[model samples]
Each structure stands twice: as C-alpha cells, then as structure tokens.
Target chain A: MSRSRIAFVTGADRGLGLGITKRLLELGWDVFAGSYLADWPELTELSQKEPERLHVIPLDVASDESVQAASRAVEATSGRVDVLINNAGIATHYPRTIHEEQVEEELLQIYNVNAVGPMRMAQSFVPLLRAGAGKRMCFVSSEAGSINRSFRDNWYGYCMSKTALNRGVQCLFDELRPEGFTFRLYHPGWVRSYMSGELNTDGDLNADDAARMAVAYFLRNRYEDQGMQEEDRLVMRDWLGREWPW
Target chain B: MDQIVLITEAHHPWGRALVREFAQKGWRVMACSPVSVEMFQDAFDTDRIHIFTMDMRSRESVQQAVERIQEQTSRVDLLVCGTLSSQGKESAGIANMSADLVLEDYQANALGPIRVIEACLPLMDHGLRRIALLSDVQGSLGLGLSGAGTGYAMSKAALHMAYTMLHGDLGRKGFTFRLFEPGPEPETEVSAEAAAAYFTGSREDEERMVMLDWRGQEVPL
Candidate 1:
C-alpha cells in the first residue's frame, strides 16, 4: 500500500485510452495499462521509460476470463485501482444498417465488445476499485449514442451499442453512488482514432486533448472538496464539462 | 384503400390507446407488441387492426414484422414509436441498476425503435410522413433530472439522437420527426388531451420536428 494513486485504463495500446494512460503517468499516478494486443510498440517503449509507474497487462474486455486475470494481476502488483477507465470499444464502420442481413451479426459482435465489455470490466475490477480512496469508474462513450442530437444515420450497430453503454454507466452510478463511489461517462469528442477513420491529423480534439480533458475531470472529481451532488453522480458530459443528453 | 399507421410497443397503455384511436378513425393499424398478440386481437377490429409479437431488442423480430406489414401495405402514413422501458422505476438507485438490466432498457427504449424505423423506411416514403417518438422530459440533458433511473433517460436520449441523425436523409425524403413527452399522468385510456399532447404540440404543422412536451410546448434539448 504505497500511498500513490493508481489507475487502470483499458485500450491502452493506442488512441484516447493510450493518451489518458500517458497523461495519468505524467501526473505521477501509477497506471496499469490494459491492452488487448500484447505487442504495442508505444506502450512497450513507454513502460521501459517509467518501469515502476506504468505496467502493461493483457486484457480483453469482452472476455470474462481475461478481465478476471487482469484484475488479479493488478491486485497482486498494485493492490488497488483508484480510477478504472473502461475505454475499450469497437465501432463497425459505415454500411451497417438494419436493412442489411449481415447487420444482425454486426450488432451482436459490436454489442459484445462495446456495450457488454465495459460492464465486464466494471464488475471484474470492483474489488480493486473499492480498495482505493477514489473509487471512480470512467466510461469512454461517444456522441453517436446521443439520441437527442443525432445528426446522421446508417451506423445502427455503433449507435445502439454506445447507447447501451451509456445505460450501463447509469446502472453503475445507481449501484455505487450510495457507497460514495463516483462514475463518469465521457463522449470523447471525435478524436483521430482507428474507429473514426482519422488516424492522422486532428479530428476535432486529438487523442491528447481528449485524454487530458477526461483525466482532468477525473482528478477534479476525486480530489475536490466539492464532490458531485446526489443528482449529478451518473451524468454523461462532454470532455469540456458540459452535460450531454442521457 | 385506407391510410396505414404503424405503432411500436403496442403493449404499453399509450401505444394501445393510440392503436384503438387510429382504428376507430378508419386507418388500418399495424401494432407490434412485445407481449402476446392475443392481448390485442379481442379488443380491436381484426379487419383494420393487426397485432404482431415483436421485441425491440431483437432486430430479427422487428424485421420479420416489418416484412409482414409490407406485404399488406405499400406505404405507411404514420410511424409512432411508443417504446419505453418500465425498468427505470424498478431500479431507482444507482447501485441497484445492473448492467444487464440497463442493457435491457436500451434494447426496449432505443435499439428496438430504431430497428423498426429503419425497416419501415421504404414504406414510409409518402410525402408529409410523420414519425412521432414518445420521448420523455427525463431524457433532456438541459433538465438535469435524468440522474434518477439513468438507463431510461439515457435510452430515451439515445432514441432522440437516432431519429435526429435520420432527419438529414429522411427529412429530405419528406419524412418529418417529432419527439413527444407523455408526462406523468398515464391515460388509463386515451383522452383528447393525451392525443393532442402526444401528436401535436403548440403547432400542428408537419414541419415542426423539434422536441415537445405533453402539453405541446417545445422542450429545450
């Protein structure tokens, strides 16, 4: 039990999750990097630089066994998780529609990884989260789930799965708020990730900007004397702190 | 040839009332209920009202129903998505809300409706087509009251966005969208006020496609 704050971030190999892991490390928190792929060059190189702080582990959010093992590994090494970021998700690219016969398969596959995956992570890592001081669970959801401000159609699987993910966050908040545990659902505003087809230049907020905002909000929620009110516990907000539609 | 209206979540009180109303108005009604079809067959005229078993969470079921409806009618004048989750009141607290249960809410409130809408689109090309979504004040982020049963509110909010996204292409195709909040008072049976509030707000024009309260007032999204 070193008093150092600890964070476990999924999808740490690249994109917003990786960016958030890096930022948390820079902020002096010991981070457990959970990546699906074993050999992500960036995570490997970064761990070498801060061996004691960043520990990369294999985690498949969709797998009960994988998440359980990852939880055990984190418990053995760090003993606690102050903040758990459920950021691992997959978006089936364009051409997904209810009319397509293949969309039924796509919806199930995407739902398993995107909607059910985070819930698995949350359930598996609860012990570690409860062991720490700030028991905050952050879900990296998306605007595609926004039923109020929906601007496009055709990506039925991605949109519905994210919507389901949002509901799961609400459930987590309902279940944990009484225990003084906090939850955050962040719509990481369009970052250049593998999903959005913006792998290069900035897509609205780059991965770093999105990650910085998300981590900042998490720290503020954790350390501030003015904790969230009862009604504010399970809210979906943009990276900039503006409340988003359910 | 009578005009056709399709209603989802017909097991709901409001949805059932709407089906009866449309049936009486001489419009052929296609009602899809998550429960048994027997609940609907005895009440309404079988000649004008058709009921089918459909679950919003399952895309396959919705597709099947849509295909069945297409066999009878070439176009649908109205598509009322009245699907909503009753699970919110059951899981009042944050901790009590399980992931599986919340996912069920999403399936009922958002995913199922979207599937129905998309499947019914081809038959929805009639000019001035009205798509009414029975939404709620709880889903509005501006109200900040959605924290209670987060799943219900989140699912409604997701449904709102899904329709709005459809507006870009669908609107241009002469489809108009409306989000209606049914308020707290459940009409044990349909009333004039309930119909007025749910179908038309301050204005009756098909062009008004924003969110409206049960009283027909525009709700800030």
Candidate 2:
C-alpha cells in the first residue's frame, strides 16, 4: 500500500465537495472523488489532470447498494482511507407551509438524501477508515441545522434534514470517538455553490474558500479534533473555527 | 359549550394523561388513537372526551380524522401533539441502525404531528389558537450526548424545527405555543403530569416560543 494519505469525498462532482477534493489533491493527498453526477465534467477533468492522484468513482449515498459498492471500489483501489467526508446533500426552494402545500413528499425526498445519505456513507466507509493512520470523519453541515441560531420561517425539509444530520453526527461521535475516531461536524457558512440545482452566486463565500476551511478542519490535530479533551464529547464548529451548539 | 382540545397518540401514557387532565378541566377532548379507543369513552365523560381512529403515518387517515372532528365541533381550541416513535432498539448506533426503523420514526415523530396540525388549523382560528408539543431532551442538539438513537433524535429535532417555524408564522397571527420536554429525568421516560401542568400554564416569554424542560429550564434549540 502507498504511504501517501488517502481521502474520500462524496458529492465531489462540483461545488464544495469538488472544491474539497481539489484542495486535498493540491495538498498532495491521493483523493477518491465519489461522483453522483457522472456527467458533471469538473471532477472528470480534475482526474484527467492528476490521474495517478485522483480516482473518480460513481457513488450515490442515498442508496445502500451504491454506497456499499463505492466503499468496496475505494478499498480495492486505495487499500485504506485516511478521511471520509460525507458532503452529499440536497435542498428545496419551496417556501410553502403545510397549509399551502403537501410537505410529506418533499420531506421524504430531502431526508433520504441529506440525512440518511451520510449514515450510509459512514457505515460503508468505516472499515477503510479503521485501516488507515488518520481516522477522521468530516460532515458538511449548515447553519440551517442550528436550531439555536435558526432564522428562516418558511422552508422546512432542508433545515429539518440538516438538524437530523447534526444529531446523527453527535450520535456517531458518542460511539466512534471512543474508538479513536475523531469527527468534524462542520457548518460551511453559506457558500455560493450548487445547492439550488445551480451555482448560486448570492452567498458571501465561494466553494473553494469553504472547502479550504473544511479541509483544514478535517485534517487538524494530525487525527483528533482540536481542543476536544474527552473522547465521548463532540462539538459542531463552523469554517471560522467557532464552536456551534449542537 | 366547552373549549375543545385535540390530542394525538392517545395510546401512549403521555397522551392518555393529557386527555384525562384536559377532560377533568371541563374542556372537550378529541383523543385520537390508531388502536381501539373504547377505554377513553368510558373513563372520561363521553360528552367531553370523544375518540377518533387516526393513524398519523397515513395522510388519508389524518384527513379523515380531521373531517370527523370538524363535523362534531365548530372549532378546536387547543392542539396538543403527543405522537412520538422512540422506543426499544431504535437507539442502535449509526452502523447498526435499520434504515426502515429510522424512517418509521421519522414518519411518526417528525412528519406525523404536522400532518394533523395542518389539517386542524382552519378550526383553530377564533378559538384559543394555542399549540402544544411534547419534545424529548435527546432532540436538543445542544443537549444530545447519548449513543445514537438516529431515528428518534433526528425525528425529534425535525419536529422541533417545525415547531419553531410554526411559531414564527402563527405567533404573529395571535397564536400561542408551548413546547415541553417532559421527563422524570432526562435519562428516563417522560413525566405526563408535569407536562400537562406546563402546557396548561401561562407563557414566560411572550415574544417568542421556547422549549422548557421538566425543571422549567430553557432548552437551547
């Protein structure tokens, strides 16, 4: 097996996931970019530029079979993975209330992709993570999930799904942190990316800058999350390194 | 004419207690259960406490239940959502959790209450327009330290956000809300009586909705 660091990122076709994969590649780590959008050209082009260092594979975190296959593919190609970033997520533009619209359909669709997707990734990638030197699990969460700091009054599923993701990460931390698996529960701080089915230009930051902060946090303390004194406790930190209430 | 209150998941202890407490206070109670509600009909005054067969998981069932409620009463004064899905083995770690089990909890705990809430909104206007929700401390992102009850915690957190959004919209429309995290302790089962009292009492913060634990401590969102 190669001594070089290995990182696997889901939703790496474009936006923050792609940006993170690019940053990891630039930092000299061999990155397995899990591409859901097989047709999206940026990751493919990046892989072509750095063929030996970047391996792009088809992955869908929402499906059990797809996640399982992606994990096996990564394990076969890379032998082990140092970091697993579960960043694949989806959101809706509908701001309608339950009185105005039937919310069950949207809730199910978003929850399956945004909340359950990462748990599937974690389950599939844990074996490879255990074999590697750096056992770090990073998540691309949002301030929308922060119930304490919540401001939006209309859309439900995205925020609810993110909140679920935050709690899910906390639960994972409770179990895995004891096994020397450190976690990064990150809020990327509203970067302009492809969350609304297109590259959004409204947000203050861009994908590359958000990915820069995310990669730095993901690799901190060599393996362990910085300032975490106890193994069982976990905190959600933003791009600015400010601790957020879980 | 008495004030009318609608409570879901009357099968659960918390739901049953709320029904009893509300009925004893001379308010008309609509106790909704998926199972047979024969016991409630005899226990409380049949005129005050009525039973409806409702399954929150099914939108059809919820719509039918709300229609039945509308035919009997002109308006519903209070809506107390007691439906929850947290139970044994649903607390399994992330790796071991069954996706079906997790989604089942989401159906019950997260989306179920809203299914009923939205249907009952039309009847709430010109009434008390008060909404009450039962929450778990496990749902609090700021308080979650337990091992993964992925579905339960996620669903509860989802429900809490829904509550927040509901408050934001309806609070401006002369509606009041009470979110109570009931417990004998945070580690054990919910305390129905304390929750009943908390729900029946006055608000501490009039400007915005807040979740209060059994000890009346303000729980962070």
Model 1, range B38-95, lDDT digits (tens) per residue? 8766766558888878777787888888888878788888888887566446455443
Q: What is the TM-score of chain A alone in each candidate?
A: 0.91, 0.94
RMSD of each: 4.4, 2.9
Model 2: residues >4 Å from true position, as ranges? A222-233, B36-45, B184-190, B214-219
User: Of the candidates shown, which would achieve the greatest lDDT relative to the real structure?
Assistant: 2
Residue B33, candidate 1: Cα error in Å is 3.3
